[model samples]
Target chain A: MQLADRIEKRRFVGRELLLWLWMESELFDGTLHTEEHGAFGFWLEKQLVLSAESESTSIKAAAPGLGREAKEALLRGQLPERFAVRISKDDEETSLVLTGDTLALRALKLATVLDKKEEAVIGDLVDELAGRTRGRKKKKAESEEDEETPFYERMSKAAEVEALLGTLYRDFLRLRLDARWDAVVVPTMRQWAAGEDVDADAYRAAKRGKSTKGAKGAKAAKGTRK
Target chain B: MSALSGSLSYSRFFVTLQGRDGTIRSAGSAADGSLPRGFLDRSYEKLLHHAMRPLDADEPESERSGWCVLGDPLDVSLPKERVYLEGFVNLGFRTDKWVIPGAMLRTRLRQAELAYREQVGREKLSRRERAELKEVVTRELRKKLVPSTRAVDLTWSLDEGLVRFFSHTASAMLSMVDLFEKTFGAKLVAESPYTLASRLRGEDDPIALDDEALWEALTPTILVPEGDA
Candidate 1:
């Protein structure tokens, strides 16, 4: 199943960092930056310029019902940092498209926080936004319906899973372990295998809080979060 | 760099927390950022009794004073004894002469961030819940984030050097005047309450220019004398 627009937009932010984390794979837990000198204007310009380097990717930053000049500036220059915004053939690409200024930086930071990339299934963000607009208009008419929907009711179970995956990614990012992929890769593979139809017993055991001990390929699971 | 002539900079501050139930406690910048013992007591002694008159304890008087400055302490009632620490810093007045020390501010903010996270560990949330919580918290932080410790508007002119200060909240301005007076030792001259009242009424009252006018104005509106009524 595909993710929604807000989730995709979040995925877009995570993707920028995820590209590096995916390649490095081993170090995806968490990453924090506390640079006080980095002004909002400075950070936005840096992320945009870096995100735009991809040849095939379309980077955009629109203020939604406002002028587009700020968005255009994000595309103008090469980023001052050494990190290249690499787009690979195997798994697609990651980048940001946003208007210039501290507001863009703030937006990017918030988007990054909300994003959980590796586990999130991708959705067409444009379609999601359109659907939301249509739903909001119609929801008012449905107010007479007895049941009330929780604020987060629309989020699927998969979205919850993806969020956990993101947290794992953030932790790895923070640890900066050289072999982080080894830490996360194997356990994720095991979980996926368990989720599959075959070896249903092993999957059930893991789900029942039995712990995935001695089920074949157990050594690979060591050191990784269960 | 030359320090400005009459400008003042507040090097440090302290806030004493007095709960509605009268549980008085204090917090301030310890030399090394650790909480000092009797902090609340000393601060209260200095600000309330020694410097400004003690705040009246009566219900009506206390209500006019202010809320519990410390706010609800880290809601320990939650599964984790979690607490959030927030304080407003007054960057010096807006004139070019005043400067906010960037390094000091960064250090304090970093400490605040670390303190918050350490108080809330991973066990506090289920794996999935923590992930969603992270996203929400991060988004909120980013939205309200300020790049530098210094957030203020600076304006300078010749006639009346009015350095109007703004901050995340009005309470932040509590020690601002004290800091200025202590460092610069400049006398604060507010218009006498009687003078202000007389001016408003278009008549000069003899009592208008006296310092006691503040106490009188604050005493509560007296009902007209029974004969006058």
Candidate 2:
């Protein structure tokens, strides 16, 4: 595919993914559990700007704290395209900005893990990657705990951030590609986003309870939770 | 540079090379450039030339803009599933006007003119003469003036062909992309609303990408009303 075409197509997925995050947060308290990636937390942090896809210029939601009405306006037809998100994994939290149209995540502020004992943990993590590449294993991760060097620590942290971002991306893809996502989850999320009373947990449980549509069984669809 | 200082923000993107099977090996290293040594060091130079720099008075007035790399990589993957590289993009601007404020310059010239007139017994200095004097004064003052610099950090995943740059300003993102592309020799595929459907559904079938109909079947997703598909 042409790079321009992919660039063009990726933003819609980004916007939808962001909408899913907002919906998941408001309804499920910003937490989602799955067998593949386990429980991950996502929350709106700092400044969050939402706009309608129709509006050429997306006005910031100035409806006060949390801006429920502004968020509702999104459900009426306007969908969230850009916002700041706080994603938590393994008890570590990071604040990042997510632009839905292009799916770009900028300014990720992960908890400072350098200079602390946590640095050793990052080293240990990179150590496990020693034998992945064949001839280039020697050129692998640059983390060195014994050195306590700034370069090594930074490398370790970057690796961790990439892994975290990848996990979140995959989790989003899972939700996005699910057969029921368009049919059931989106509609359910619209209600919750619009401030309508709906049992989000129950709805998720029902989703978890059933096999994916069209697919033969839980094993076939990879949708069942442990 | 620490090679790894600190960043409060970053812009994230995916990198996809042209023409490749889905196999993981194709994702490992860039088609060119090694990490840390060749890539990072060279990239540092590329960025500095683009960052803002202090303008000297003797130098003719022009648009003075440049950037630099702050610290080292928080991560580097030479030949692995992916290479994660992060650095701060340091930017600064030294305007002749800002460094040599008109008000300040005028006042200083007034003082110099008085001294010159008192010593030379002159009423008014010619434009060329005044300019020559101000030029010398501006040069002396500007030499001592320091240009203020600001920086934003970025993370790039070579194999995934994605980058996460930390800036919300559209103008900043554009420069980030330009410097990044120049430094890496690779184009960044940004995620936007219009492109979402194509990215996730871009591959109708890895084996059948050549089929024009397959590409047509994948419709890009746009923001529609809740009831609408």
Candidate 3:
């Protein structure tokens, strides 16, 4: 088979990964602490979009700050084709509009280090460029600075973004391709997604059909989706 | 540092490709680590030239607005590190417009009506004619006008299968993909679940991936609230 065709057959994996991520976030308080991915935080932000893989087109729903509607969409048996998600590992944070099939980061918000690193570079470059433009007069005592960071800052930040994306995506792949992933991880996630006890089948059975028993009180807490 | 101050660096995509010798490399080098000179490649320009058509259907190629690689790769990083590209593309489209102010246009129409006296006068133009005139005027004006210019920012990580482009519009994305394919003589598939999955599986696990039941099982079953179900 042609390489494109071979890959196209598996394009749904991206979507499924995204769907899995959304489910993970919704079920696990957006805290994913696998040995591989570390204690990463993921949250579906202001928007949530779901589409059937079989569907030819895509549409998005704006997830409310309170995630009742988004949860309801999950109850609707649909999966996301594209959605904006916030991912963080402690102080570092990135927001991305990740598409399912192509695993494209259609829109990306780089990690916070983006600005810190960028500003540092820009400041240094600007100082050097400024020095060159004005014949290298040494002036270390300037309190004020140009309000705009030079455009060149994007190059360095782009490198950082790519690196971080690679790391995160690899983490995801590690999680997905693990031998235990399909058999163990997903079923537990499925239970978690429904706000059920992973161990207690009876509790899940009873929780079905309008029985607000175990953690209706903690629903908002477990899934702090907004 | 602050959320409000945060701005995106660029849109990131995954590029996967296979060579003729059955070697599939997501990120391939030109052997010497140079950004594609494909902007100057005749095929790239020709493809873009046709895409940006003349403002009018009958207008010739000379009148068309199109894309050009403004210059060399905007920036090239080390011996084999990275390449940044800034592309220039022209946009041309016919517009029906009136340069005259609305009040003036109305006044002119009223005056032309008065000039008619009885039936329509020589100065009086019908709505159809006025629209036709507008098209002709706009077309002529368009010739004098330069096509709008936009700067596309792109960075290709030579070693990583990543391309970060600032523009996310469909047109820009398609253009970048086309440009990359032409430049590298390889296809760039935006790394997605499927492509990534296939790559991760490697060439050895063909049987596991190809199993129809395994593929079917991989499909998601939406576990929704039974109430909705």
For every candidate, C-alpha RMSD to the true structure in Å: 31.8, 12.2, 11.8
User: For candidate 2, lDDT tens digit of each residue in B106-217?
Assistant: 8877888888888888898889888888877777667777544335545454444445555556666676666656655555555553333333332322222122332333
Given candidate 1, what's the lDDT at residue B157?
12
Model 2 over residues A144-178: C-alpha lDDT tens digits? 32234454454456556655545555555544444
Give the TM-score of each candidate: 0.19, 0.56, 0.55
Quantify all predictions' global Cα lDDT against the true fold.
0.26, 0.51, 0.48
DockQ: the better of candidates 1 and 2: 2
Please list the residue runs of candidate 3 whose C-alpha ends up more than 4 Å from where it truly belongs after superposition: A1-11, A26-28, A34-37, A53-66, A111-182, A198-226, B1-6, B9-24, B29-139, B198-217, B224-228
Interface RMSD of 3: 9.8
Superposed Cα deviation of residue B37, candidate 1 (Å): 3.2
TM-score of chain B of each: 0.23, 0.48, 0.46
Global lDDT for candidate 2? 0.51
Which 10 successive residues of model 2 chain B have the least lDDT summed? B72-81
Candidate 2 docking category? incorrect
TM-score of 2: 0.56
lDDT of 1 at A41: 16
Once all C-alphas are superposed, what RMSD does model 3 give against the true structure? 11.8
Question: How many backbone overlaps does candidate 3 show?
Answer: 11
Model 2: per-residue Cα lDDT at residue B22: 34
Which lDDT tens digits does candidate 1 get at residues B1-229?
Answer: 0011111111111233344476533222122333345532343323222221222222122111111111121111211111111222112221111122457445554554555557775334455655554444444443343222222321111112122232323344444444434422232221111211111221232122222322222221111222432
